[model samples]
Target: MKAGYLGPKATFTDIAVQNAFPDAERIGYTTIPDCFKAVINNEVDMAVVPFENALEGSVHLTTDYLFHETNPPIRAEIIVPIQQHLMVHPMQYNKWNEVERILSHPHALAQCHKFLHNQFRGVTLEQLTSTAAAAKYVSEHPESNIAAIANELAAEKYNLKIVKENIHDYDFNHTRFIVLAHSHTEILPSLTSTYEKTTIMVTLPSDRAGALHQVLSAFAWRRINLSKIESRPLKTGLGHYFFMIDINQSIEDQLVKNAIEEIESLGCHVKILGSYFSYHTQK
Candidate 1:
């Protein structure tokens, strides 16, 4: 099988794809949207893209595309620990004082904000498309003054020297990646793991009182454990929106099915985005 990921190689997404689909052929795309398009267009059997980061919240590009552009079912989820590093070209001097500017993806820069401010006070910081892309740029430029914040894999992949390791301000940083496929038929049932999670998009009935509460009440009465509940705009107009709720068990459970039925009876719409297992990698 073939899988797509955002990369030139060595980005967190690339690492997650490698960890989750070790035996599959990996295809790298330049951007997150490209990965999604690759899956939607059948350019690849599936795609792994960032959904949320523990430190940085959601990846707007991925979230927005999932909401507006396509409806490909998420086959599984992967959470990988993120360890950002400071790297420079091998020929470049290996000293922090010699670095003139720092390069990385915006999210990586943000994750290491405090460290950058304290360690390299006034260095120029630039954002690239991905962490691995930044590392690739630093490798090709061969300049002595620029450094990139990426990962160990990137440093090795690009043959860059690590000036500093674990540069992220927080030690428990992680990013949640969602595995998406063209449809349910493309999902490999044999590969399903445990820690099941069911994600559903719910649109509340308009002009109703306590509608949102009623939706939650369905799960509450059924004693279902909700792992996450978040809201997003419906894009039709102001004040119109939908909620994405994640339950702690698979949709095959009778309790979960009944809760959805009760929610729909409340004049709301519910769409099961995916009922797949989640994989958590060691930090």
Candidate 2:
């Protein structure tokens, strides 16, 4: 099987893909939408895309594309612990004191906030498209006094040396990546039985009294546990938003199906995003 991930290589998303499908043929796309497009166009058998981060919250591109662009079923989920390391070109000054500028993706840079403030106080922080992109830049500019905050895999991939390890501010940092395909059963029949989550997009009844309350009541009366519920604006007009809800149980459950049907009966629109299991990997 072939798998595509967001990359120039060595980004957190790339690492997750590597962990999940180590033996599959791996391909890298430049952006989140590209990965989704690849799955829709069949450029690859499957695509791994970052869905959410423990520290930074949901990846907007991933959420938006999954909700509006293409509604591919999520086959599985991979949870990867994130560790950002400070790396520099081998030929550049080895000492951390020699670094004048820090480079990484914006989210990665933000994740190392305390480290940047306390250690590299006056240094400049440059944002790139991806942490791997920053590593590539530092590797190419050997004479420059720049360091990249990326994963150890990035250091190995770019032939750079890690000067500081685990520079991220938090120890519990993790990013959730989802595997998407045209059909889960077609991609991997065994995974279908592992389904544990049912995500749905809900648009509530407009100008109706207790509309939001009624929506929650639909699930509450059925005793269906909600793992997550977040709102995103519809963008068509003011005060128009949709809720992305995750039911703890699989969509195949009769109660879960009935609860969703009841939600729709209340003049609300519902769309099932996917029903899949979460896969956790140890570092």
Candidate 3:
């Protein structure tokens, strides 16, 4: 299937998509919102969008797009381990001392926060839209004082130099991504019932003290454990909102079906996009 991800190319989001949807035709878009919009417009089969990062907290724009805007639901979730490397033009800067300004996507730079502070010291930091974009800029700028923090794939893509290796402070850093599709065809061929988590979105009839409790109690009463829950405002209405939740039980289970039916019976909207574990949702 045709899959789209955030990029100009070689960004962490693009790398996540590539790792998650290995065999699919991988296409890169410039922004996360554009990737989501492509799915809404049916420009691609499913678009990979990063929802949150271990270091940067959340992709609020992505959350907003998925919740506030009228669009297809998130069919699946993918979690990609984040690893970053520093790349530069060797012809211009042969050594770390040759660089004074480092560039990267804001999140990437943030993940490698300690690394940058200790190594670069007082060097200037330039924030770009994506790591690939930063590499692209470094490729065109030809400045001995410039370097970029990006994936090794980006270094190969741009033929940039690698002055450092695995500079991210934590090796366990991971970014969670979600796949957007036209409703029916969200999961890939390898994705089956073996998945450990199912992500879904719901909208309540009205906001009240026990409004959330009643819906959550449906799952709790059924003995289905929830892993995550988040809410974002509705675009058309000032106070109206929607929610995204993760439950341990897959949607294929009878209990999940029953809970969903009960949730809808409460005059709310229930949308199950897809069911899959974190690892396979990439791309």
Give the number of the best model, judged by lDDT: 1
Q: What lDDT would candidate 2 get against the real structure? A: 0.84
| TM-scores of all candidate predictions against the true structure | 0.92, 0.93, 0.84
lDDT of each: 0.86, 0.84, 0.80
- lDDT per residue for candidate 2 within 1-283, as digits (tens), equals 8888899888887877766667778899999888888888888988888888889888887777766865578878888898999998888755656698999988899999999999999899999989999999999999898899999889999999888889999999988888898774355422223337888888888857788788888789889899888888787788878888889898999999888888889889888888888777775
Residue-wise lDDT of candidate 3 within 238-264, one digit each (tens)? 877788888887788999989999999
Give the number of colliding residue pairs in candidate 1.
0
Model 3 ranges with Cα > 4 A deviation: 186-196, 203-207, 233-242, 264-273, 280-283
Better of 2 and 3 by lDDT: 2
Instruction: Give the per-residue Cα lDDT of candidate 2 at 98.
Output: 67
Alpha-carbon lDDT of model 1: 0.86
lDDT of 1 by residue, 223-270 (tens): 999988888778888888888888999899999999999899888988
